[model samples]
Target: MAVSPAPSSGHLPRTSPRSPWDAPPGGAPDPWTPWAGPEALRRQDPELADVLLAELRRQRQDLQLIAAENFTSPAVLAALGSPLANKYAEGYPGARHHGGCEVVDLAERLAVDRATALFGAEHANVQPHSGSSAVLAAYAALLRPGDTVLAMALAQGGHLTHGSPANFSGRWFDFVGYGVDPVTGLIDHDRVRALALAHRPKAIVCGSISYPRHPDYAAFREIADEVDAYLIADAAHPIGLVAGGVAPSPVPYADVVCATTHKVLRGPRGGLVMCPAELAGRMDRAVFPFTQGGAQMHTVAAKAVALGEAATPAFAAYTRQVVANARALAGELSQLGLTVATGGTDTHLITADPAPLGVDGPAARRRCAAAGIVLDVCAVPAPDRPGGCVKGIRLGTAAVTTQGMTEPEMGRIAALLAAALREDAGTRAEVAELTGEFQPYP
Candidate 1:
């Protein structure tokens, strides 16, 4: 395998490879040729393909720690590039707004049915363009405008769609938020119950983007029942683990569940909504016409392919390994004097308070990027109590673990992170060397 160039310190550009679709030196077929979509740049400026190819190579070679990013299988990628992309199949199967969509509709229906089976939901809608779109549809189905909603506070490991003031969910409806217990960095179910009783929200949305533990969907159900509110589980991050029976599933407790097919599911970028039988019609209506039109049939096909994979025993083992890897990484980080949230993780992500290490989330993310590891900058909010600081940086083991990384890899990654924070040049070189051609799950 060939190695990509190393990222330089202090001035590393955001790394991305444009394409990996070309045949290698021996003229053999490129392994990734099937999924490499039409090169928008290659068609317009042929010379740019080299740069894009370099970027793609860098991504494969580097350590991907982004909580929401991963490498999809070639099978799923092939489906994404299929002829389904050309179809404009509006409406459900056998009820399309466009003709010549028979095969496309079948492909999409397969995706919906497979997703329903995978999650054990009564109905599934695989059309929302992204996780945020899927979430909006769920909200639209369950709440009227201005209805009060209870969701996890963003600064405390919640998603933007859950009720961030700057997001559409907060703008369109009245939103109240609950947070993790500051001392333990874990969600306080008692606090959630208190808030639900006080607010009597239309829906209690449960899930997070940076949280380090499995959400208690059953508990959220109890809270919602007490308040006569609906339970919406946005299991976008842990859906794969849930499906593999490694994490507690929300299907039994949630009236509506939303997820993205990427991340741990390892599929093409797309979203899905799974609801109980009672909300089938409303959820469908919310997803269509209300949120979007003309579903991306290609992506839906890819989603079906991925969902099929998720049902396999291998995928189950893969999901378990991801959580195990996360635990290993968290333990190592904690040993390195970083404050890992919740002490450790029950899922594939972990959060650390970088303030004690003399850095902020954005700066830490950039430093990791420069050292050939990628991460997202997370928000930390003000507290009712005084003398609080930002929550810090978040990381995940999904991508690296998928690349066949184990405890040793986790330790190396953690050490690289510490060195990056300390501005140690030797550690960055070691990271680049260790990460060469490290494709997860290939």
Candidate 2:
């Protein structure tokens, strides 16, 4: 895809006038002031409060490109910091193992209901603390110990929970691997089908953390059906796009779907599991007694807030702009002679090897960070010849887009990235200037 030309002045369109706080809650502006308790904490422990405030300042200043990260709304943050964090709800809404559960029950039910509605799933478990836990719970719910499972390979963008040898998912289950075609950098459906038939695995896991294209969930479902394997879609990265109706949902095809609330969903840092009605009981049990003890009610409440925001038309526009910004970034990078994996992005992330610029992934990441552009070192597919680890840097526009950056901003960012790779001294100042204009949480 070609990079869209920016205006002659090199400026992009401004962000939407609609602010998240503009909407009235319950048809009226919230009259209660945002709590000033943080000030009390600042007075009580100046050092710790300074650390928290410093982190917020850092987020406000840096150009965050981390694919796995995003900025949650003030409402979500408020809920996370609420007193519900004091609760110890050890079970589901109606079946808690502790007292004083009435209010927390409402929070969890709201989270579950909103999540189900967002994803069009029959049931949702909002308790898993992170995406890893959600993936583990899904495995526990469907597969017995040592059951054979087929999943995408870690080096090719699959997450650790999918089957990294270091993770419990690999230790507990017999896992076989698949990868994207090296030349195309896309999953080959024929290869997946062949592997499923050959391994005869108990489960097939789809979805990825770094892949920049849309997943073929239906193809995975067809292969799963042919081999009688349960299809698990770990959509931790694209859940917001899926919810916003920009990306195809895995719910209609997969037997189980797992996601984190924080990524593009812009919720608090938490996880969710969704499955068919019949699997709901097992999934709930796996999440509660099997993987976690008590539910994090505060985070659940925050997720409820995010789900509510995601259901709005404004969020849909936000998510679509996220994709547009990603494509612009990828296209601009490629136009500047960088090799963006899969050519360009159809999603919010782009993986580019900086080898052409005479640096490895880690070195490039350090350079970018020094310039105040935050991203991560990632692996690329190496399907043909033997080489050292195929290292690259992964970038995402979710955070920047949330801050209202658009295509011209993407062009500026791409130039900064290039200058960063080249170790140009001026890049840092340029990055700081750009970040100043799109201050997060402002």
Candidate 3:
């Protein structure tokens, strides 16, 4: 057969049409194209897609006041769903067990670099699957089984992983608990020192889940030094604030800092551990071979994106607004006859005992949910009562701040909460109108 005698130098003879896997005339795919979303899920499983869409609608239509919640960016969401999720990188960046970790190594490295930069820490391990896991890893790194640990009381704004009787920490360690002052509803430094001096715990943890004020990390460090204990700051709720420079950082004071990426950081649901450079190896070992297996590379990539976002000036403004909105909400609640814990909030959350409004915490939360305002029931500083008693409602402004609400909007939300607690007939309509004005995902 006569071959095409001579194909032109610039233009070769075409053999076949382009396949779906082939790139376009350009070198790479278009980045702006909508790659994955509800439509893709709908195509695969319509029922699950509907549920997700309904959840999106619910989030858009209702207020989210859960203290440990926030709305992440679309970029972070994209990172969470990226192809990196397909990989299984079982160890730290260069030392991973798997063969195809070059790209995942870059992802994890970027996450670690960004986290360390954001927090001004010596080292970072962005591997733990959740905040609780981060705390577990920190414990594993610092303490041995049956070692004494002094942590805040769970009923007084402390987290379960800090040493609740039902948790692994409590079961494995000899945990001595401290509480905030019943009168101030804030941590009592004297009491903490007393307990630390008395128990001489191996580790002293200072942080809270529902606390509404800035923690005295300096004092905690002093106490820890006096007792020769390792100080751990479980800053799950305030990492974004610390990164933005609007709140005090525990990195300089604590031996190790544990945090969740999603809560205030507004990233994917993941965890981070930052510590002094000297302890980096121990922390990494604890997180990988001890607490968890293969790191979630996708979430680590999302965390890198969030840390990048948080380092910008715009995120600083957002964090400042979050604190302002929280203060405004607490003031409004007090004006509307609610007893705000600590009189008001210095952070992004307001813990209020609704008893002054003639409603229990659970009842107030239910009423607010019915009126399209979401929050969580919390325990107050009631030493006489059991830990399960619903004594307060904890509300946060992180999600609302992400929705672009301000001080004026906080006032309106407080009014809605007040009216809802009282069962006013028009409160639900007001909530619907307000939520329509500020869509969370829009």
Candidate 4:
């Protein structure tokens, strides 16, 4: 393994011109400390400190391509670790069920207001524990149990929570799924329309976890209108892009939109639900005293800080770069003779169905891991098809591109993937050396 010098850390370089894999001071203290534990407790657990330090270093070394992950900013991290974590604000701002929640209520209210401005929604609920939980709350607010719901097919780029048999959406409601066109690998509006007419669902989910193409929310709205269904746009993957005005905003087309604060929003690891003011109270009630108890004030504060950042000009530029980086990565991968799902991506995530490359998702992900390129396997439909064994692999450019990777980096990444897949040990060694060439996340 040839060792190369490290590049500058993305924003604020943590270490000097030294190895990022080095251990942190105080023998690996809890990264989420000063809040999660007492000072005495942290002092008593030095071994646990070592483990966390190693974990952070490991995370820095690997390129996280998983679409669901991101590098939260230190500002947001600081808010999450602040004293707000100790407060137990059990209700909405200015109307809390508990006392001494003035600051905490302010934090939560700020998050709500920021989210509203970011998405231009009539109302925003920044309280759900996560994106899925937000969606669950939306369901509770809009439809009754056993109401028919239409969503995208999981194998064709839908989320498990959308209607997968394993998820709560499926367990509670009658589900009818719509998939993309087989020949074009894109969402088929006509097909979705047909499903809507047949099912007459109470709701239709309009976003996906693995979709590489931009959704036509207007068309989806038409379908929902045809069946009197509420369109819930799960913009978890592209909310940041939409917020930054780089992608289509679902808030206008869908009756409600649910998204995670982290993914593209680059906020705290939480969820947001946006809807008309008429439905806002129902959504809030569904989230609090209905689904969850007290809100996570610290997380809410972090979410507020992140939403503020997203409202800035810099975050828009970052979102734009994320799209550009994804397209570059897809084009470069295609050059490597790898078939990217739908030929490429319209969002941040690229789905590469490696059937033509003579590999399955698990094998390719394993190879990618060995080469220091983190990738994940997606569920592929039709196990009997030539390249169809739930073996699809999905990668995104949000994190690495945010780290400042450009076209040149994409080119290098594609070459590394090709070499790793080919099992060329010598070439693999050369590729491994390149990992150190870039600055690991600080």
The digit string of per-residue lDDT tens for model 2 on 1-442 reads 2335655543334465634433344543222223444754565578998999999988988899998899988899888877688899999888899998987898888888998888889999999999999999999899998999999888777789877889898788888888888789899889999999999999999988889999999999999999999999999998989988889999999999999999899999989999999999999999989888998888999999999999999999999999999999999999888878889989999998877778879999998889888999999765553642388889899999999899999999999999998989888888888999988877
**lDDT of candidate 3 vs native?**
0.87
TM-score of each: 0.88, 0.91, 0.91, 0.88
> Residues 25-64, candidate 3, lDDT per residue (tens digit)?
6545422223444544665578998898999988898888
Clashing pairs in 2: none
Q: State candidate 4's TM-score.
A: 0.88
**lDDT-better candidate, 2 vs 4:** 2
Per-candidate Cα RMSD to the true structure, in Å, reads: 8.8, 10.5, 6.5, 8.5
How far does residue 221 in candidate 2 sit from its true spot (Å)? 0.4
Worst 10 residues of 3 by lDDT: 1-10
Residue pair clashes in candidate 4: 28-49, 380-390
Rank candidates, lDDT, best first: 2, 3, 1, 4
List where candidate 2 sits over 4 angstroms from the true fold. 1-34, 383-389
Clashes of each: 6, 0, 0, 2
- Indicate the residue-level lDDT of 189 in model 1: 97
lDDT of each: 0.82, 0.88, 0.87, 0.81
Better of 3 and 4 by TM-score: 3
